[model samples]
Target: MKRARGRGPLSTVVGIVLLALMLFPVYWMVNASLQPAGSTLRGGWFPLHPDFGGYAVALREQGRNLLTSLLVSLGSVVLGLGLAAPAAHALARFPLRGTRAVLLAVLVTQMVPGIVVADALYDAYAGLGLLDSYLGLVLADSTAGVPFAIIILHAFMRTIPGEIIEAARMDGAGRLRVFRSVVLPLSTNALVTAAVFTFLFSWSDFLFALTLTSTPSVRPITLGIYEYLGAHTDQWNAVMATSVLASLPAALLLVLSQRFVTAGATSGALR
Candidate 1:
């Protein structure tokens, strides 16, 4: 027990060193954004006289695109959960034939390259008139979100005991009611987990956003940053400022959603 009490000091120091190495780039990105002007990272390690000019330009130019990304990500989350929850519940509870095959297919879809999916979607979307529209992006993003959510939701829901589900049924609750009142309420963590991951996937998506949208009218923030690479390379501060703005939402979501994945604990002990 004493041996398992904590890691040794050397191990802790090693871990901290690795963590700092990983975070150095993020620190540099923030540091670069504050500089008034820099063709390269000659702004030193600290910004004594921080300039807000880059942030000003980012907000004025990319604010609308940022809002567009937020809208599409949220839409993908709702649409993904709406489909995945019921399907995952059914897959978890029912002993339907070919369940393993279906799960395998879902996993296989993840292995398929995003570029291929984007190309196929482009052709279908062009005929269906979904190009360069909010609905189009939402639907495209959900192709990733829905499958991933199903995998996450299914893994969690499977842990729910059959006895609890039976108790709900014995009390005269319909299948839908039991799902709504009991299973869903107890699986709150899984639902939130799935939603958060789905949101992040849709948020950071560049391929589908790049392929599906042509006009600037429905551009996401990722595309906005791509524009900075060409048009504003000389303005590196603005470019970094745009990157910082883009990373803020995903970072905040990850920080705010505290994941407590209890291993094989009973539902009563969850809270």
Candidate 2:
């Protein structure tokens, strides 16, 4: 028992070290954001005298872009989940033919370069009058989310016991009823995991934001950050501050959905 107890401290130390290494970049960003606006090279390892000017400027300039990103990300999540949930359920529970081929096709999409999709969509959007539109950006961003959500949800859903679904059906529940009441409720962890990742994917999307929208009226935060980088080359603090602000959703999702994320990973792996 003493020998086993002794190993615990070593494992704890290693874990702490690994966690710090992972978070160092975030710490650096926050530290830089607090430094005075100037050449980032002149910033110190830590900010002894924190400055708020960077945040003020970031809020003033990037606020609308941040809101645009929020709306687009939310829209993408809604559309992605609406399409993916039913598809995943069908793929997992229904005795549909060509399931393997369908899954393969979905996986193939992840391999296609984002630039290729963007180029194709740009031409399509131009013809459809969707260029520089909110709906266009949302749909473009959702291309990343939908396939991934389907895979994750399908993996998790397949692990649900067949007997449980059978019992639900035997209780006078129809297909949609069983799915809504039983399958979805049991798949909460996977749903949260999918939603969190989809939100992150849409939120961090830069290529689609750059290619799909030509007007400032619908620009996302990622594009805003790019423009900021070019126009305020000397204001590294504000740039870093904007980056930090943009990263809030991902951080918050990870923290809030930590338990569900762990469960989803384990469940999906077993499937």
Candidate 3:
């Protein structure tokens, strides 16, 4: 048998260097968070004497914002999936008219600049008394999640064998039953993919949060961090500490669900 080949030394070195460059900022953020001064400008390369005071201050100051973010993100996931999954299923399985146009419109919406959506939603939301509210934020964030989830779920649903669906229908299952029992179970990977990304999108949303809210009520962590950047310019460690905390959920989720994400994303591709 032939021996297993390894990457060339030069390529390995290049990859290592590139990785270091990409990850340097993250390491620096953690480093700054550990510094007693929380000052990046004067921070040492290593935390010879680490300080977690920054985290204490972050928890004390921004805890409510973090919780608000979680609630809004979760709400977005629920609303987004509720809307996306069915639309995707109909588009993929049904021979509805203008299906292609609707899909195209979805793609176009993604291309529309976020600032434009925020601007338009501001007046409409204000008129509806949704300003500075969790519902408003969830609705706005769902714009991003719903479209993305539709595209992902559509692609994955298209890969479901036609015979399986027909068999389910023949067994006295109506359309809704077929969808709930047949389609959803087979689409687990895609559902997880959509849910994970939806959560991430809503979790990281800033444009809607910034535009729609003028009050201290329902502040997500992104807005909290932005205001903190200005309000606590001297306390870089606390800011960085909050950054680390915010990064944790998304990072952990992505790492844990990487396999499902990759599988779902690539499921419909033909060989």
Best by lDDT: 2
Q: Which of the numbered candidates is closest to the native, going by highest TM-score?
A: 3
The whole-model C-alpha lDDT of candidate 3 against the native structure comes to 0.93
Residue 94 C-alpha lDDT in model 2? 87
Residue 129 miss distance in model 2 (angstroms): 1.1
**Candidate 2 ranges with C-alpha deviation above 4 Å:** 1-22
Question: Which 10 consecutive residues of model 2 have the lowest summed lDDT?
Answer: 262-271
Model 3 scores a TM of: 0.95
* TM-scores of the models, in the order given: 0.92, 0.92, 0.95
lDDT of 1 by residue, 88-170 (tens): 99998998999989999988998889999999999999999999999999999999988887887788788888899999999
* Model 2 lDDT per residue over 1-271, tens place: 9999999999999999999999999999999999999987899988999998999999999999999999999999999999999999999988999999999999999999999999999999999999989999999999999999999999999999999999999999999999999999999999988898899999999999999887889999999999999999999999999999999977888899999988987897866
Residue pairs in collision within model 1: none
- Pick by lDDT: 1 or 2, better one: 2
lDDT of 3 by residue, 74-186 (tens): 99999999999999999999989999999999999999999999999998997999998999999999999999999999999998999999999899999999999999999
Mark the regions of model 3 whose C-alpha exceeds 4 Å error after superposition. Answer: 1-7
